[model samples]
Target: MRRYLRLYKLFVLQYLKTLMQSKLDLAIGIAGFVISQASGLVFILLVFTQIPEINGYGIDQMVFIYGFSLLPKGLDHLLTDCIWWIPGTFVTHGGLDKFLIRPLNVFFQIACEKFQADALGELAVGAALVSLSIARGAAELSVLDVMLFIVAVLAGTVIYTSVKLIAATFSFWYKNSFHIINTIYHLNDFAKYPISIYPKFIRIALTAIVPFAAASFYPASYFLDRSSLAGSIGIAAAAAAVSGSAAYGFFLLGLKSYDSSGN
Candidate 1:
């Protein structure tokens, strides 16, 4: 564990050095992400202009959920987003052969190959929105609420990573699973609001199939005092544990089928 951590630190340093060579490009990318996130929020604001609330959630609560969703999503994007490149770029272009030859874990090697700086913009915006909602008295959190929110965020990050991993693992057979990964990942947009607003089938799909609701809706609902604390925490934790374990197991299984490109 210590060795891996040290190696990851080294990787981060090397990645930063590379990024520094193109600082302007990095800045533009981050700025683009910030603009994109702001646009989404603007769309939400426009929707609320026509209605008092969506379901039982007010504008502040909805924004809180949206911001809370970004925390875990941004963390996953920052840390494990390289997984998304695996199927389409790495495997298809034989870039994965280099990682397979390394002494380190292939997944670890892939993850450490690059650090996404654009995700910092998402994190910044997310924090700002959450702070805004809190300052407006949208939710009054106790110490336990704060602690549980942290846990929920961590669990949600794992859930996001796990889903991406599972989708990427499909590349072992498909050779490219970008479409599947994108479809599943984009489902998080629905999770930014209350799941109750959706149809029963969509609700079930978000909760049971993709489990995006577990990553944001359920956890944020609990934080906002819209759901039972124990139930929310339990569901989020269990979803994280089950999804993560299943995804890792699937990845290991798929790894056994990996065929080197011999490049």
Candidate 2:
């Protein structure tokens, strides 16, 4: 474990060096994400202007959910963004060869390859909006609430990563599953709103299948006192564990079939 941590530190340092060498690119990436988040916020504002509430959820509550979603999304994006590369061009281009030749675990090596600075934008905007929700008297959190919030966020992050892994692992067979991964990941956008507003099928799918609702709406509902703490935190943790285990199993199966471009 110590050795693994040391190697991860090295990976982080290398990425930092690369970022320092491309400061302008880093700035653009961060700014681009920040602007994208700002645009989403603007859309939410426009939405509330047209409708007084979305399925009994007030603007403040909806915004709280939106902001809460970003916390887990940004945390996952920062750490495991490299998985995006796998389904994009890495598998087809034989990039896994380099990792396979090393003694380290392939998934660990791939995940640690990059540190996404752009995610800082998401984190910044998310924190600001959640704080804004509190300022608007949307919710009051006590010490225990804060602790549970942290646990919820961590579990949510795991769910995001596990979902990405499940999508990206398909690249082992399809060679380039970028479209699949992109389509699946974008579904999280729906989680930014109240799931109750959606149709029964979509609500069930999000809650039980993709389970992005566990990451955002459910946890946010707890904070807003719109749902039970047991249901919120318990459901989130359960989903994370189940999905994470399933994703890892799928990844192992995929790795077993990995042939590289040579095969």
By lDDT, who's the top model here?
Answer: 2
Q: Which residue pairs come into collision in candidate 1? A: none
Over 4 Å off, model 2: none
Task: Report backbone clashes per prediction.
Answer: 0, 0
lDDT of 2 by residue, 1-263 (tens): 89999988888898999999999999999898889998999998998899998777788887888899999999999999999998655688878888888998888988898889889999989999999998898899889988998999999999999999999999999976998989999999999888888899998898799989998889889988658777888899999999999999999898888777764
In order of appearance, the predictions have TM-scores of: 0.96, 0.95
Report the C-alpha lDDT of model 1 over 167-228, residue by residue, as the tens digit.
Answer: 99999899868999999889898998888889999988887788889999899888786578
Error of 1 at 78 (Å): 0.5
Quickly count the clashes in candidate 1. 0
RMSD of 2: 1.5
**Worst lDDT window (10 residues) for model 2?**
87-96
